[model samples]
Target chain A: MTLHAIDLSVSRGGVAVLEGLNFSLSPGTALVLRGPNGSGKTTLLRTVAGLQPPLAGRVEGGGEEIAYAAHADGLKAMLSVSENLSFWASVFGTGDIVAALRAFDLEALSDRLAGTLSAGQKRRLGLARLMVTGRAIWVLDEPTVSLDAASVELFAAAVRTHLGQGGSALIATHIDLGLDTELLDVTPFRAVWRASDPDEAFL
Target chain B: MIALLTRDLRLGVRAGGGFGLGLAFFLIVTVLVPFSIGPESALLARIAPGILWLGALLACLLSLDRILALDWEDGSLDLLATAPLPMEGIVSIKALAHWITTGLPLVLVAPALGVLLNLPGPGYLWVTASLLLGTPALSVIGTFGAALTVGIKRGGLLLSLLVLPLYVPTLIFGAEVARRGAAGLEVVTPLTMLAGITFGVIALLPFASAAVLRINLR
Candidate 1:
C-alpha cells in the first residue's frame, strides 16, 4: 500500500505556499523534504498531518492517524519528561513511551521538567512523543534541531530502524539525516517575499 | 476521548500552579469589595450578586490566557489537532478542564464569598447556582476566543478585547439573578435567560472555535 498526496496546494496569508504538488511513498521507504526557509516545507508537513487545511487537493492512505512534530518542541515546560511522554502515550492509546524515550537516551531524564532540559534534550522529548503516537506515518518538521553529532546519529538510527520495520517518514530538514531517503526539493514553490495589503489579500 | 480528558484534568490539577494563583486572585477580589465599598450591611447586601458575578468573571478572565497558551507553546495542541478524534471534541474536553479548575471551584466557593458580602442565606444558593450554570458557558465561549488569539503574538490584551464583549450578556444575566436574590425577588427570568445563552453557546461555539483554530494553525 502507498500514501499519495495528489494535486496538493497550500496557501498562507493569501499567498500560495505550494501548488499542484504530487508525491507518494510506501512502507519501508522515507522522503526527505528540503527547501529554503520560506519554501513551505513545514506547511507541506502540516497539510499532510491534517493540522492545516489544504488550499486544494487530497491525501489518501494516510487516513486520520499521523504523528507530527513541529520545529517547536511541544513538551509542556511544567511537565517532567516522563510525564510528557505519558500524556502523549495516553492520548494515542499506546503506552510505548519507555522504549521511545530509551531510544532517544531520554530514560535518565524522564523525571526532569522539559523546560529545564537543553534545546537538544527538548527535541529528543518531542521525538519521543512522536514515537509513542503509534501512527503509521510520521510527518516531521525539522525533527533534529538541537542535537549534537551523537544525538543526531541516534535519531538517524531510530529512523532507519523505523523504516526497516515498515514505518514511513516524511521529514523536513536542512541538514543531512543520513537515512537512505528519497529527496523532494521544494525550491520551486518558494515565495520571494510576502507584502501585506488588505485590498490585495486574495492573492 | 477519556485519555485526553484524563490527561488534561490531571495536568491541570498537578502541574497547573497557575490555576491556584487565579483562585487566590478571585478570593482577594471578593474580600476587597466589601472593604472598599464600606461595610454598610445594606449596601453590601444590595451589591452581593453583582460582586460575585463580577468576581467570577474576572477570575475566569485571569485564567483564560493559560487555556491554550500552554498547549500551543509546548506543541501538545498541534498533536491534539492531528489526533484521530475531531478537533471539536478536543476543545470540548479542554473546556471541561477549564471548568474544573476555575468555574467549578468558583461555584463551590461563591456561597462563602456571598456571606462575606453580607448576602442573605437564600441569595447564597442563587449565587452558587448561577455560577454553576454560567461558568461552563464562560469556558466554552472563552475557548473560542483563546483559539482565535493563539496565532497572534502578544495576544493577552487583544484576547480580552475580543472576548469581553461576547461575555456581556452572560454577565448581565448572572449579576441580575444575584441582585434579585439579594432582594428576595423572583429570579426565574434572568436565570432562564442565562441558561438559554449558555446552552446556545455550548452547542455552537465549538464549530466556530475549530474553524478559527484551523486558520490559526496554518
Candidate 2:
C-alpha cells in the first residue's frame, strides 16, 4: 500500500497556505518535506495525517495506518518517560515500548519524570512514540526541533530501520535528517496572497 | 478506552492535578452559603437542596476544561484523534474520566454538604441519588463545551458559558427531585425525568462532543 495526495490544498485559519500539492509514498521509502517557516509544513502534515480536512483535493491511503507526531511532544510532565511511552503504546494498540525506549536510547531515563528531561531528551521521547504506534506511515512535524547531533543520528537510524522494515515516513522539518529520502520542497506550491480573499476576512 | 480512562485518572490524582480542586470548591461553596444566607435552620432547610445542587453544578463546571484542554495543549489530543480508537469512544472516555475525577466525588460528598446546608433527613438520599443520576449528563454536556472551546486560548470562561445553559434541564430535574424530597412531596416524576436525561445525554452527547473536537482539531 502507498500514501498519495492528489492536487491537495491545505489551509490554516481558513487562508489557503499550500495548493496543488501532490506526492506518493510507497512502502520502504521516506519523503522529506522541505519548506521554510510559515510555509504550511505543519498544515500539510496534519492534513496528510487526517487530523484536519484538506482545503481541496484529497489524500488517498494513510488513514489509520499513519502515526502523527506534532511539534508538541504530547507527554504528560508528571508521568515518567516509560509511562509516557507505554501510554501511547496502549492507545495505539501496541505493547512493545521496550523496543521504543531502546531505539531512542531512553532506557536509562525511563523512570524519570518527563518534565525533568532535557529538551533533547523530551524530543527523543516524543520521537520514540512513532515506534510504538504500530503503524506503517509516520507523519512527523519538525521531529528534530531540539535534538542534539548524536540524537539526530539516533533519529536517522530509527527512520532507516523503519524504512528497512517496509514502512514509510513523511517528515516536515528544515533540519537535515541525514537519510537518502526523496525531497519535496513545498515552496513552489505556496498559495499567493490576496487582500480581497474571502479566507482573509475571517482572520 | 480503558487505557485512556486509567491514564487520565492517574494524571488527575497526581501533583498539580485538578482532582481535588472541584471537591474543594464544592466544599467552600457549601460552607459559604450558610454564612451568606444566615444560619436559620428553617430558611437553610428550605433552600438546602437547591444550594447543594448549585454547588455541585458549579463544581462540575470548574473541572470541565480539564477534560480535553490538557490533551489538546500537550498535543495528545491530535495523536488520540489519529489513534485506532473512534473519536466518539475517546470523547466518551474523557467524559467518563471527568465524572470519576469530578462528578463522582461530588456525588459521594453531596450528602455531607447537604447536612451543612441543614438539609432535612429525607433530602440526603434523594440529593445523592439525583446527583448520581444527573452528574453523568453534566460531565457529558461539559465535555461538549470543552470540545467546542478546545482550540481557544484561555477557554475556561467560554466553556462555562457554553455548558451552563445546557445544564438547566438536568439542574431543574435534579433539584426538583431533591427539593420535593426535602419538602416531603411526591418525587417520582422528576426522578424519572432526571434519569432519562442522564441516559439520553450519556448516549447522544458523545457524538456531538466528538464532532466538535474534530472540528476544533481541524
Q: Against the hidden reference, what TM-scores do the models get?
A: 0.93, 0.97
Q: Which 10-residue window of candidate 1 chain A scores lowest in summed lDDT?
A: A191-200
RMSD from true fold, candidate 2: 1.5
lDDT winner among the candidates? 2
Candidate 2: pairs in clash = none
Q: Give the docking tier of candidate 1.
A: medium
TM-score of chain A for the candidates in order shown: 0.91, 0.95
Interface quality of candidate 1 as DockQ: 0.64
lDDT of candidate 2? 0.92
Writing each residue's lDDT as its tens digit, candidate 1 over A1-203 gives 47799988876666668888889989989899888887888788888887767778988888665678887776777778998888778878887788998899998998998879999998888888878888878888988887999999989998888888888999988789888889999887554445665654653
Query: DockQ of candidates 1 onward, in order?
Result: 0.64, 0.87
**Global lDDT for candidate 1?**
0.84
Best TM-score among the predictions, by candidate number: 2
Clashing pairs in 1: A74-B74, A74-B75
Error of 1 at A166 (Å): 1.4
